[model samples]
Target chain A: MYTRILVSALFAGACAGLIAGILQLYFVQPVLLHAELYETGALSHFGAVPISAHPELPGFDLMRDGLSLIFTMLIYTGYGLILLALMSLAEDRGAVISGRSGILWGIAGFVAFHLAPGFSLPPEVPGVAAADVTVRQIWWFATVGCAAAAMWLIAFGANWMVWGLAAILLLAPHVIGAPEPEVFAGPVPTEIAALFAARAFGVGLAAWVLLGCFAGYFWQREGVYADATQSA
Target chain B: MTTMTNTRSGLRILPALFALALGGAVIALTGHVQAAALHDAAHDVRHATGFPCH
Candidate 1:
């Protein structure tokens, strides 16, 4: 059972990663490269102070992009494993993951991973000012954890009290609030940042939606059928 | 194929092992080396999560 879950996750994740990587290369990378030029003084935004040029790393663009693709693939594949494991567990309890309702699973994956966190922190473009990384990382993890739990409860929680609690947890992160930059000063233009943010969000949404559908489809293929008797 | 795990445990374990190793290597590489693009991607996720992982 675990082996089936693993293979399914690897294949599905790789597919999502390949699709997302291509999408990012086209829709997202150009925007990032554009912003980097500003960051590196190869270009400037609104005549911002002439920033010092940092030494370029070896392998340059090619290495970075390759690594980006590899990293993206790895991350999604790992996520796939987790999602499949969850589905199997859910199946054990009689939830059927099939072609028909898989897209709903995909949407849930999107909401839990991308939308929930996105609501708190929209994607940032290159050279944009932001708060300390550690604090933000902690908060972001907390939010993903809370939001994921809340979403699960919303989906499968049996009681109204569970739903009420889910609502509170969902709101908890926002109420506590994400940490903000002390001063929002960066060289990137607002228009460019806005475009980048929107595109990035779109990219994630598309990828995660794909993740969900793939996970659900592959899971069913692995033989997790609904047992009518158990479901009752 | 499904029964392989029951009879030939090794084959069943191969895929999981391979994935684990590949996943581990990638994580190790990303952890030690800070490539800007990777950093940017992580930053986007972190920032999207409203977290600053740098």
Candidate 2:
């Protein structure tokens, strides 16, 4: 059983992470590279040459982009491990797990991991002013934890009080508020920042959906094989 | 039957715990680590995937 769970998570995570990394490379990385230019003062928003609507971005560097791809896979695989663990727990509780249901799981994952925290602390560009990293990280982790708990309650809770608690869990973090920098200032244009945030969310949604589907599929397959081996 | 189910569930718990711990550690390393080299290596991804970063 342990090996089955581990193998399922590893395969699912690797597959989903590869696709997510590629999606990031294509849709998200260019915006980041562009933001870096403004951050370094190479392309200033208010400079002599106003930034063009579609300025030429730096071409990909193999080293930088390659590292990003590998890291993305690692991060998503970590997410996969956590997700599969939860799914396994759910299955033991008599929940049916499958690729179809996994889409909903994926959406829930996105909401918990990305949307909930981002509601207050939107993704930022390279040069953007922000709160201290440690403070922000604490808030981010808290929000994700609360949101994940809330999602589980919403899905499996049997009564109104449980639902009520879920609502509180969802709202508590935002009400307390995310850490913020006293002054909002940065070299990157707000337009660029906005674009970056939107694309980040978009890629996140796609990757998570894929991750859920893959996780669910592999998990089911592993269960079948485990049973077959037992019978054999 | 009840004892069999209990034993099976008990077997399941250890792996689930292990997965959660390992997964959480990997995410912390990639997304939350504070070292400069780690930050630079994960910079673009940190931004792209929406992990909070400098």
lDDT of 2 at A103: 82
Q: Per-residue lDDT for A5-64 in model 1, tens only?
A: 777888788999778877776777766666667667666644656533442423326655
Computed on C-alphas against the true complex, the DockQ of each candidate is: 0.16, 0.85
CAPRI quality band, candidate 1? incorrect
TM-score of each model, in listed order: 0.76, 0.97
Q: List the residue pairs that clash in candidate 1.
A: A133-B52, A136-B51, A136-B52, A137-B51, A137-B52
Reference contacts preserved by each model? 0.20, 0.83
For model 1, residues B1-54, the per-residue Cα lDDT tens digits are 768534555543454455545644553344223467657545433322222445
Q: Which 10-residue span in candidate 2 chain A carries the lowest summed lDDT?
A: A45-54
Candidate 1 scores a C-alpha RMSD against the true structure in Å of: 7.6
Return the clash pairs for model 2, or none: none
Candidate 2, superposed: residue stretches over 4 Å from native:
none
lDDT digits (tens) for residues A1-232 of candidate 2: 6777788778888888889889889888888888888889778776666667677887878999999898998999899899999999999999999988888889999999999999999988899999999999999999999999999999999999999999999999989999999997888888889999999999899989998998899999999999999999
Residue-level error in angstroms, candidate 1, position A115 = 1.6
Q: Which TM-score value belongs to model 2? A: 0.97
